[model samples]
Target: MTPTIPGFDYQRVQVAEGIALTTAVGGSGSPIVLLHGFPQTHLMWRDVATDLAADHTVICPDLRGYGASDKPADPDGTAYAKRTMAADIVTLARALGHERFALAGHDRGALVAFRAGLDHPTSISHLACLDVLPTLDMWQVMRGTNAAVGFHLYLMAQPSGLPEQMIAAAPDAFFGHFLDIWTHDPDAIPADIRAAYLDACRHAVPSIVADYRASARIDVDHDQADKDADNQLDMPVTVLQQDWGAALGFDARALWSAWAPKLAHTTVTCGHFMAEEAPAQITAELRKLVDR
Candidate 1:
């Protein structure tokens, strides 16, 4: 079944060589690129995109290894780095004729958005991150039994074949585990959306793992470089996260303030899948961010 989001026109473009990006472009005015997270495709933003597209041109793309985007083999971790992935968005935006645009990402996409804001500050007009902390803060906050909540981070962060093979053999279980556990309301995701994620992950296992592995090593250096440059998103930033990090020993808002000069940071009761679990609230928060 081809799932549809009302009011948005779906289009596929070859945004990168040997890799075509499946994007949904709709509405008018300034552009807002929406990036979806791990275990999901651009479809995760269906409802949110509709809301935003009424007045703003919303561009939602399946990040390189997810959704309908090309899952071309990137064996060396060269392209899957969020930095490179972030650049892809910039290229896609330029192709769409926007010199600068607002960006919002969820989960893995949040990390990518962070990279885009820091690395190409001039290209991203506004930044919004959903349901994730900065990578370094996430590393520091996980310790003891509290770390169990994010065991996949460590598992996927491990070196080489182990994590990849383990997940490949049981991709369904691996991806479904998150869908079942991460949501406070599983029904909020609906069956087709959940299946779409599992299907994408199963097919794009290597690329997905590469995305995580890059975070473990190269992404750290990327983040460190931004910190060293004292480069921050000059535009307004809105960070929405769950309160879980607090229980696990992290001040979510305070940490974000270090990277964003103008920030509206808050924690909600929603679980990891905030976009799906709390659509109304998430959409409202995004409206506030875009309007700001």
Candidate 2:
């Protein structure tokens, strides 16, 4: 059976000059665009999107490089930057007839959602970020041994060739490693969906690496510029994470406060894949953001 978001109609829509995103659209009401994280696609939002679909138009997209979307090879890595990915979401929402929408993202998606909120404040009514810090904060906080926790980030950030070559040799293992280790519940993502995630990541090795590379390179430049400019998220912003700040001995809320002046930050014990491990809680927080 094809692994897909049940009841959601899938479409590939052009979001930029050379970029088109594969999106799953369903339900109807206040629009909410859900962005999936690394090595995963919109499938990450299966539970949360379906539940939220009852009341809102939930649009889930496989960010440009991660799924059945355009993966333009960018030597400078700007093509896969969160700035570019965020623009894809803005164009997608407008194309779907939503001039403005509520936005939520998990992991890498949260990164894009972060950029979207920063870059397209007028287009996002409320923003919810799951299991991630702003790019600038993410790089700042990971120090010494703590940085070891994100070995993949450093690995993929290397200039071309190596990461792609090594990961491509064992794509399933690379992608499946996160899908397995990042969650409190291994079965939270069932077999078929897991297979789909693995397959997608396996086939899109270079593009996925490019996406990560940009985070360490161009994405940071954009984020640092935003910071220097003192740009804050203009809308209500809610951040949900596994309390990495507490574990890593940093003030997570205090850090988020700098980016989101109006912020509601929550720490969950649901592990890294919070949307899947604790969908009800994730959905509730998202609903609250939209209502707020």
Candidate 3:
């Protein structure tokens, strides 16, 4: 069982046909769905969710093929596409009695939130993406030295069996590498929580690889189509990133402005796990979205 966030009730909600989401829900006010990132579960939102629960109903879910959620065998990348993942979240909130809600995501989840804002504009009232760029822009921005930071993206983007096979051999090290490298503080994640993450990854090799693979293939196709159509998110959007653009030689805000017209962009000093590294600040930012 996933460790329960304080004052939250856990549920395996059937959000679609044969798709059930492991969700953690708490508080009572306007709804806001929090999405977790790669190499972690909804538990990543514990501090932020509990803090926001004072005024907002926070819903955190393990995205499809992640954590304790239903992991369908989707080697083709179609099922793991952000389009499908975003639909899963939209369906989840509806099941929870929310027709429209605020949305925030970190890492992989942020990608899903990006899709949610584009595909289901009326469903999402406010959207926040932490520590990521859009899928197409992600590939465009990372080059040469900057690409080194995204080595896992290239590794996991490989053919179906290969990535999963290599990951299966040493799942702990493969996942824990990010756990160790992506954070500003080693002590930010509790030892017990780290162990849980490692243990989960050990058993989730294929599904997790499939999720990453989709990002490289089908997810990129979806994003490219959106770009070709000149599509943009028609919602109040907030972006908090670590300013990879500074080191990467690109204008992050310029890229994001193309997607989010009403954008509130800030460069956070924290690492990839900003929600954990700066929960108070993240919570305060989300509260601003709430007030807006």
Candidate 4:
């Protein structure tokens, strides 16, 4: 049976130039877009989106180069940069007649939400990020022995061709490894969903590798440039992350507060895949963020 998030309707919309996002729409009232992280899809929010759709209009999209979205060739890292990916969401939302809406993202999607809030300050009403820190802070603290926690970052940060080639050689195993390792609750994601994720990653290895490679270099530069310009997110911001940075000798909340003045930061006892592992808790947190 084709998996479906209850109360949600899925569709593919042409959101930008050569970019048509696979989006799931449901509910009524104010619109909210939920972006999923790496090695996952809109499927990550299967439970949470259905619940949110009971009240607000919940829109979940597989970000460009992931899932059912368009996978155009990016000549340089700029194309996969968070700023570019965020713009794609902005375009998609506006095209759907939502001039202003709350935005929430988990993992990689959260990075894009951060960029969207900064780049399009007037467009985003509320912003929520799950299980991530600002790109600049993340890079600054990842060094020496502490880097082992994120060894995949180093691998994905390499030349795009190599990681893409290597991952493609065993796409199912390569992507499935992260899926299995990142979640605190293994049963949260069903086998079919897991297979779907692996299929998507396998098919889009080049773009996926480019997305991470950009994060290592160009993405950091983009984050720093925003900081230097004092272009902070102007809306209410909520950041929910695992205390990995704190364990690694960095104050995660303190750093987040610096970038988002009207911010509520909390550390949750969950693995990197917070959405999948703790859907109810993540959903409750999101409601608070949206209600705030």
The per-model lDDT (C-alpha) reads 0.85, 0.89, 0.90, 0.87
lDDT of 3 by residue, 64-104 (tens): 98888998888456888899999999999999999999999
Tens digit per residue, CA lDDT, model 1, 1-292: 8576677787777767887788888889889999998778888888888888878999998899887888777667677888889888988888888999999999999999999998788999889999888887677778999998888888988877899899999999999998888889878888888888898888988889889888888888878888888877788999998887668787888889998989998787877888777778888888888788
Order candidates by lDDT, high to low: 3, 2, 4, 1
- Which clashing pairs does model 1 show? none
The best candidate by lDDT is 3
TM-score, prediction 2: 0.98
User: What ranges in model 1 sit over 4 Å off?
Assistant: none
Clashes of each: 0, 0, 0, 0
Q: List the residue pairs that clash in candidate 4.
A: none
Tell me the tens digit of each residue's lDDT in model 2 across 90-187.
Answer: 99999999999999998889999999999998999999988888888888999988788899999999999999999999888888898878878887
Off by over 4 Å in 2: none
- Candidate that beats the other on TM-score, 3 or 4, i.e. the better one: 3
Candidate no. 4 TM-score: 0.96
RMSD of each: 1.3, 1.0, 1.1, 1.3
Give the lDDT of residue 211 in candidate 2.
88
TM-score winner, 1 or 2: 2
Against the true structure, what is each candidate's TM-score? 0.96, 0.98, 0.98, 0.96
Where is model 4 more than 4 Å wrong at Cα? none
Superior candidate under lDDT, 3 versus 4: 3
